[model samples]
Target: MVTKKAPSAQTAVDVALAELVEGERRWAAIPLSGRRALLDQVRALTGRHAQRWVDAAAGIKGLAPSSPLIGEEWLSGPYVFAAGLGALSATLEVLERGESPLDKARFGRAGDRVTVDVLPTSPFDMLLLNGFSAEVWLRRGVSPAAAKANAGLAQREPSRTNGVGAVLGAGNITSIAPLDVLYELIAHNRVVALKLNPITDPLLPVLADILAPLVEVGAVRLLTGGAEVGGYLVEHNSVDHVHMTGSARTHDAIVWGTGATAAERKLAGTPKLTKPVTSELGGVSPTIVLPGQWSAADIAFQAEHVATQRLHNGGYNCVAAQAVIVAADWAQKDEFLAALRAALAQAPARHAYYPGSDDRVAQAAEAYPRAERLGPTGERLLITGITPSPAEPLLAEESFAPVLGVVELPGTGAEFTAAAATTANEAFAGTLGVNIIAAPATITELGSAFDELVENLRYGTVAINAWTGVGYLTPTAAWGAYPGHTIADVQSGIGVVHNAWLIDRVERTVVRGPFRPAPRALLHGEFALSPKPPWFVGNKTAANTGRLLAGFGADPGWLRLPAIFASALRG
Candidate 1:
């Protein structure tokens, strides 16, 4: 008997790409029903391994299984992924019936651009995410009729041919990789070669189990390694297209070869990677605070909201609130800052898990030495009085850590909003997302002007009284940067993902939520039943609520609603 040697990493890459080439040939020919069945199988597998998946992620992130922070893993990991599967399954069902998913979609006008209501898509959405709503704004000149016809074009066409696509996963977010795979397969009708980030190597086993449905069929191939393997897959001749969820640095490195010559390549409008590329990149996301007559309760609640926006996942999110813009003359500026500081201090301290997070936090501290270090361990940083200048490090860079910067502008009401929007558009490093926090009275007073303000701000997602992460989690809503980005200057990278409805000509997603929770919302005349969201850092019952939500997402049914509501109410 002779000893056998396993194939090397390079050989594995070659084999995976070769297999995906064949898978892509058959993927387009598979009817809608067959694809739907594959999705259903994956959803079931996700439910079966949901707990193990959450546990593994928690362990990697320094969260004990019993720790409340473990909720972050459950929600961001399996819950959102499961929800995406459910959304895609529903879309497939509609397509199989030879009907448009947008047939019943409500359309409205936003500054001459047509907007389609995407959230609260079903009665279940209403009950689950009660006060939350999202709208997909179409590109200029895209009529509602055109949007309806263009929705799910790949699925509608019978002669569509597909090819192999590569997904370079994000290290920070667990669901980004799988969700990107889902979008590539369903939305683009392509087979995928998913390369997990090195930091997420621990998840390889669980993902292999959960994604076995597609892996077994060769429609998807999961690989593990670092940049060398990733570069190999990206440069593979057989891979037709590539999509990535990471930083612009990584995107640029792949598109234009890194080194001193990379700049010259970018300037010359030439890319080393000839294949079409789509990416979701991070940026300095802003949370614009409009001057308004706010009560103390309003100040406290919104402060926590802002803190959660910045500190969720220990501030590793691409949409994390990097800067909070406020009016310098606002009377309650001090009060709001104090409240926000308290909120930051109250959140439990966790390890800086992501690679280079310590250096990033230290860089923010070094730049702004006077920045306040809050929280138990003093790792949470809050820098104040930052000027909106290109020279400002925080303004020009994505911190990707537990760091928040405050910039105060001189104005009131619409004037402040317009200035802040302009600064956010010009000063921020990327156009991934921005948030606006305005009181109800202020919005009512501004009316159409407020809509105009939101319309003019150039971000993939403009969230009002909500974190842009809500838009990312809403599978029906498109997620990416503002359009018109060329291959040379990929700000937040090009193209959109997680758009289950597959509506094209998308400009951005607008997500709005209640400013207050439950009883307080009722007092504010906002008819919303949701309690503190599970993603909140201080939600006591977050672990329980997130677990229940995961179960609900895995297999949605009326029977699961009560338990979910019960856990959420306590949170």
Candidate 2:
């Protein structure tokens, strides 16, 4: 099928910027009912081409035709679109019923801050996410009363001018760009001008198809090009808000000048671009493993959990675990490490699809001269035991590759968790994702101590016994770093996204998972979940499993359950 070629970069930018000028008004004027109907249409359109999207993304990345790694494409591609649309649909449904955005959500107050249980919005969410739950903790001084009063900011302040939002798309995740656009539209009530990352341009046609309804309504405009085009768009006078999914370096370059000029400006607390820029930048995210007694099976399961955190998407995710923080005095540290090595060894590695991955891997090696590169037996290196340079690159830069490091802290038990939190907060430069893998007993033992530790972690999304990306997939769970970011040194960018609840004041989200995998033989249990959850690169039937799961979510019926269950079992 011959497709219409994208216009020249300059022309694309001109067209996008102009379209956004009108689109923002049109979008803001669109009622919740209209938005709901359009989103329903978009969901159907997205569901129609899930397979072609997976195939195109997978094949272009050099993944084998039958490779389970294609699951990454399906999950990050169609599944996210379907899930995000469902979330938006639900929010619109609430508005249609003349209720607040989080009307049914249970809100709790802890001292001055407000806590909202946003996930598991329905019994179906509980069933879909068995053994998993998520909650959003509002920023300090945000009382539940204030939250309740200003719950639906977008809907309440519809006449307010949000102008236009320009989203600099991430090349890796196929869902990221559109998902970010959705946040800007539904949460901020702004029209979006999305510049597709040049690397993922092959998926642009697919994206255009998925977003056709919005595009037709003049609510979204797609542009494509390298840095030059992005540079032009960011500096475009009409662009009011900027949201990007890339490195901090890219953020700085866009908000400030490049090289010495940028450094000087950063030091002076000055920025070249003075806009409300929001970004989900890279970070040195660490997964803390608390010292605890564990059954052999539990050890194996958590090991896979850790491995999946690092090896997912070949560890290219901004939220992927870059370092493993283990308790130094733990008796089973070596046992868990061995199990992790074995799990990684069993998992297959694909090409480092992202550009500059090799350089990033080399940078990690340079940081720890004695580091040994471990692997999943393919064209990749999982760097282990990197000397921690808290202020420098290894422990600061986001290594967007299948590279990981292990650090064993001297602190143990609650002390260990506190120390790990300190390291994650003080050492890592970005606050996008944080993971803590503690046994249920450890959490219970720590009690309020664990809650305090979580409160201090300083990430947009925090997960226990699960990858931080779980927060990314949680629609109601806001996805982005904690607030208070400056353009000079935007750690994980400014502002947040994936906040389907339309909560204006968000601090962080906590997603909890089971310590062990669900039972293998049956579909129903205490921990029923999507097989290997498409994020796992090792699941052989991930593509089919993800498609079935996506289809089920888009148009769920009892008939689809059996096929989804069967495919999930295959994985």
Candidate 3:
């Protein structure tokens, strides 16, 4: 038997804190242009070292080098960092200029000044859905009063006395933790130190090199170790702010403590100490298939949608759709399931992490013993029959595998909408990305209710007719939901990431995709050869998209026709 050793608590904390201090000083001193240049360099470095990074990441995660998923990660992961750079640059421009135009059509003239519209992108069919929007007050001359008002709206300043940031990287996804670090440093303008989970230790050297510019400039740093290190870092006196992307149980333990400490804290109605820790704990995100919207083709399209969300990264994602909330009266439920099963049957199984994954799946199987199983080595794609209790562990708890739970509610239009809203609001984990698939008719019929649901959903990202995970990679979409009570009440983390354009954000983001066919579908394993793609696998895709968008910018109608056609045809 092979034995694993945990790092000493003191050693881990020391290393993490040292990095944090360095990152803080560096971020505070660096000029915006220098920061931008470093980001650009990192983007170039990512492309140059793409294969090496992928290999290192795959080796550590125990993934096959040739796996399509690995290819996706290699291409889409780094682009998120590049997108972050772009967003940071835009933010800086807005900061320096006092106002930057985002969308022209949404702008209306208020006397001489322009009123910019920050309406989030809404699905074409579901215009009634409440979308998040932020208003940017702009004028030719800088108004001190307006600036003061805008400054007051800022969440927290970088100079706050209690400034501290800790990042806990995900064990399965190599890019997540580092991205979180980037958000804290650039988005929130905070000092940050990242603690690497043991499973992803091999990539630490690569991450160190990739982030060396930030380190050399003192904007970021990385630390490696296990539970002791994590515990010490979270509990350290100097660490005031923290963020983690991992299990909800882990977040609970850190905030509430565990064992004797937890019991004491509970009895006393107080935690060990109050630190503002934020976490992107896992969620059992749901996809609501509204009736009347899906055809055989639509069902097939969405089957790939659900399958891609679950099968991506072997279903280790926090925002991966774990449950499909369908209307009981929907005629195409069985048809959609058939296509979903077929798609899942073809997906490769991932390496089961930690020892209990198999056990967890087995436990889930007992509730719906007939559920189909898929990969991880003859892994079955388990689907539970329609049940009365949608709040069962299979639906509520994070399965962390290819297993999906199905729940049917009796209703067609508004009734169906109400049930989905209730379920998503009450039964889901703290953080979620709720996906609602509605036909044009269904959307029209329940437009008001859908809007209400979108606003009421506790999730961070509520996607319409698309998988919610895409929000993570979209440069315009903010990653975090909203601020929670405290470190203890952190439901889906405190901040956002992957928004390279760094605009003023609302509470949640709503991503609109076509109900029938999207321009690029990375979920169906189709992006392998397509020019347009949505794979969150690597950061290269962002650069490609940026370049393509920039080219399109150069020529709106004529020169970019090929690129536009390629994007649509590729889908």
Specify the highest-lDDT model's number: 1
lDDT for each residue of candidate 2 in 73-166, tens digit (9 for 90 to 100): 7777888778888887887787767777766679876445788997778766766666688889899888777776677667665556488888
Estimate every model's Cα lDDT from 0 to 1: 0.90, 0.79, 0.61
Ranking by lDDT: 1, 2, 3
Task: Estimate, for each residue in 418-490, the C-alpha lDDT of model 1 and write its tens digit.
Answer: 8988899998889999999988888998887798789889999999988899998898999999998877878
lDDT tens per residue, model 3, 1-571: 9988876667666766776676566566566556667766665565555556667766765667555455445534554455445555555544445543242225433333333333343231022112223322233343433333343122223343235578888887667887787677766677777888887888877788877777776666677778777878777877877788887677778777789878678567697647766667767778888778455666766677777777677677787777788877877777877887776776555576544667777777787767776654656455756453446776667878767877878887777788888887667665657787776556777767777766666666777765675566555556765445355455566656655444443345566555544323334322222332334222223323433433332222355545644443433
Per-residue lDDT of 186 in model 1: 82
Q: Is 2 or 3 the stronger prediction by lDDT? A: 2
Q: After superposition, how far is residue 168 of candidate 2 from its true place, in Å?
A: 0.7
lDDT at residue 4 of model 1 (Cα atoms):
100
Angstrom error of the Cα, residue 92, model 2: value is 1.8
Clashes of each: 0, 0, 24
- In Å, residue 515's CA in model 3 sits off its true spot by 1.5
Model 2 lDDT vs. the true structure? 0.79
